[model samples]
Target: MEFNLTWILLGLPVAFVLGWLASRWDLRQVRADNRQAPKAYFKGLNFLLNEQQDKAIDAFIEAVQNDPDTSELHFALGNLFRRRGEYNRAVRVHEHLLSRGDLSRSDRDRAQHALAHDFLKAGLLDRAEDALRRLEGTAFEAEARLALLAIYERSRDWGQAAAIAGKMQQAGQGDFSTRLAHYLCEDAQTRMAQGQFDAARKLLEQALATAPQAPRPLLELAQLQQRCAQPAQALDTLENLARQAPASLPLAATLLVDVAQATGQQARVQGLLETQYRQAPSLDLLQALVALDQHIGVPDAPGRARLVQHLDHEPSLVAAAQWLQGETLAEEQYHPAVQKALDHAAKPLTRYRCAACGFEARQHFWHCPGCQSWDSYPARRVEEL
Candidate 1:
């Protein structure tokens, strides 16, 4: 066929015009679809802002159905379901996302994390543990490990908790030495209850080695030694505690007094407690000092004098009550009732309070029952605080 320049020129413009029209049609269709998806999404957002979760869920479901391939929508819908306590639906949505081969690596990790959260909120601990463990080398590793630690702690699996804590420490998540020591202490307590004294002692020693600055291990070790009829060893442990962690001496005060009496070292312990009291006065230390003095043949007058001295330093009601208990009041007939009232008023001051959750207990707790925080209770009593 012979080439026709005129026809060729005409055909080029016609093809161009058709191509432009087709492109415009596709663009308009895409805009319409985008607009429809956002309209439902905005409606969901409005419902969520109004605190109408049910309506928000319905709107989000409609949006997800309209845009099934949208990863963001799937994530939003799954989070809403989980928040509404609809774990099964949330699991299905995240599982559907995970099942897609087209999902990016980051989105896949995100979906896995969401699924783990769903299982955790549903109280399916075993399922949650498995799901979290799969996230081990991902960006969510630290968070997953923390969740696993909590699960292990809730189950009273101290060994698993220690393992997770050790991993977190190695990852530079935070200094978990104190937490690890607490886990060891918990395990040792269980061992002690089972009459496994040797195992308990070894665990406590390991805890001391793990966190030398942490007072719990030292205190627990001293108690364990005393229980094992090794008061001399217990006294040595408390002396090391006084030297290394003097700030924690108040918490170990009663134990110190008991050990000192048991080992016939009351005079030496009395001097140590007096020195600690001079540096940082605490009601517990004062009580320990008085007990020690009384054991070493000190008169009631001098022992009561220590409480008066404490009052001069810290205006403590607990100290005043202790002082009055030994005083000979002029109205001897009313002394008993007056002393009873003072003791009752000072009782709460002697209790230990959790720093994290304001939980008051008669004894110090390494782990707070109210907030599940480790080492949350300060060494001092409520009065000292």
Candidate 2:
């Protein structure tokens, strides 16, 4: 029994020493792994600071492989892939992060946003839309909704766009009255095309009610009135537009001329356009004035003189071109060549340019086709602007 007791005492110390050694070995392994993680992370950061994104991505991937629990490393790699336009790989990385159970709620939301961005960059709009929709109710809700708004606009789903805009407006994002009115007007146009005139009129009326000062609805209503052969009503609507949205009168100037000529209200129409022109002189408004006078049998000399007066005020290439169209050039032989050159030069200047993206178009746009911004184009032509 004594011998057994002596052996037990000796074995206890040996076991204690062995346990301490095992713990030290484990601690060393953990410390080494922790140290390696930071080292790899710093290496990636160094590459990133040098703008070597490819190498940075490689290092970050290595870091993620070693420390699979590190969500930050995964995020970095995913973002790197996205920046490099490797959307598929970025999507894979973010999707893998989302699949991990260890990710926190915020991290999950971030991963979801990243994944959506990847899908968007890859032109996988359907996938992006699905991913973005999942972000609703989270902190990413506003951002997601904004992206969805843009997506809906791109798809020309005016109904969905209006719904999203309504939500954003409710959330105090910004005033979307004008945007909503535009959507209603677009729907009204579609309904009119489908021969649903009453429905179209109702929608346009709703648009005007939504934004009292908005010119588009009144202009559209006037157009609808003209279409239905209600020339007097169209003229009244345009006159109201001139009072309510004077700055946008140029957009509806041609319509005003048509309605006035139809109703034989040339004198009243000329006064309205002239008043607008005096306030905000635009080439369109001037042209409308010239047309009105010509329609009422004004002499050719007076019309030519009006063009000269506009050129003096605005110094516009377009006005000068118009004036020259009727004038006999001093060098009659070279007149055709000079006129052709002037027309060529004025052609670009005559285009309406988007204020947001500088995309020039032959016709004015309420919404820019290139940038997809509402009311991005100024009513004035490029030369006037």
Candidate 3:
């Protein structure tokens, strides 16, 4: 074949031009893909900022499909799913991230934490507990422990709660002494209900040793002692409570009066209560004092005088009603109706109320039944507060 130099020279430039055009087409395609991904991502972000979560979720799904390798996009999608109550989808996303062997250690922990949260939100307590347990040695240990504590508390698993609280206390998270004591007291209550008196006593004793200054253990132990027919020991426990936790005396005043009468320690109790009343004249303590005076054969007139004295200090309607119940009114027939109305009005004022949740109860509670908050109710009654 004869060589054509002119044709060969023309064909070389044509081939070069074709190659350049192909390269330009590939670059433009890549730029378009990149632009589409960001556009979807920004659309999602705009939706989120506008609080349009459903629309944001759709946009994020589009962005994730366009950029499947982006871990942060996966996380955002998972969080959005969780927020929208799509817990199963959130679990799937986090589990996919966790399955990626190329994920960093920190990212794996984060994925695990997110998965635990998904389980929690889904009300899958067992799965949530397992996932949280796996985070024990991670930087999320403290947070995981706290969540576990809440779970245990909600489940009424006091032993587990105490163990986690002990760990958190050891880590210097905060002072969990009172919380630990409460757990012990709760456990003791369960044991007592099961007719395990000895075990219950031991648990309460341990609780007192754990937090000597905590009022609950002392009060619970005194009740246990009285139940065992050891009123003298119960009186001693209540005396210790009065000394260690004077602010909690009103809650224990009725118990004190009972134990004192049982143990023949009315004089001692009367003096202690008088001293406390001088410091903080609570209605409960005053009522106890009156009951004690009646028990010890004090004059009725003098005993009724105490309620009038309390009215001088607190301007309490409850006190006025109590005082009038024992009075000789000018119109004796009308007195009964007036006293009945006064008592009816003052009944609610005698109820104890939770300071945290405003839950009212006829009796004082160491823990709020409504909010599950410990020590949320003040010792004082509604009228006193």
Which candidate has the highest lDDT of all? 3
Model 3 stretches with alpha carbons more than 4 Å out: 1-18, 328-341
Model 2, stretches more than 4 Å misplaced?
1-23
For model 2, residues 319-364, the per-residue Cα lDDT tens digits are 8878888888678998888889888888899889999999999997
lDDT of 2 at 330: 75
* CA shift of 347, model 3, Å: 3.2
lDDT of each: 0.91, 0.91, 0.93
- The C-alpha RMSD of each candidate to the native structure, in angstroms, is 5.5, 2.4, 2.5
| Residue pairs with backbone overlap in model 2 | none
**How far out, in Å, is residue 244 in model 2?**
1.0
Q: After superposition, how far is residue 44 of candidate 3 from its true place, in Å?
A: 2.1
Clashing pairs in 3: none
lDDT of 1 by residue, 296-324 (tens): 88888888888888877799888887788
Residue 271 CA displacement from its true place in model 2, Å: 1.1
**TM-score per candidate:** 0.87, 0.93, 0.91
Question: To one decimal, what is the Cα RMSD in angstroms of model 2 from the true structure?
Answer: 2.4
Ranking by TM-score: 2, 3, 1
Mark the regions of model 1 whose C-alpha exceeds 4 Å error after superposition: 1-34
lDDT, candidate 1, residue 269? 86
Considering every candidate listed, which one attains the maximal TM-score?
Answer: 2
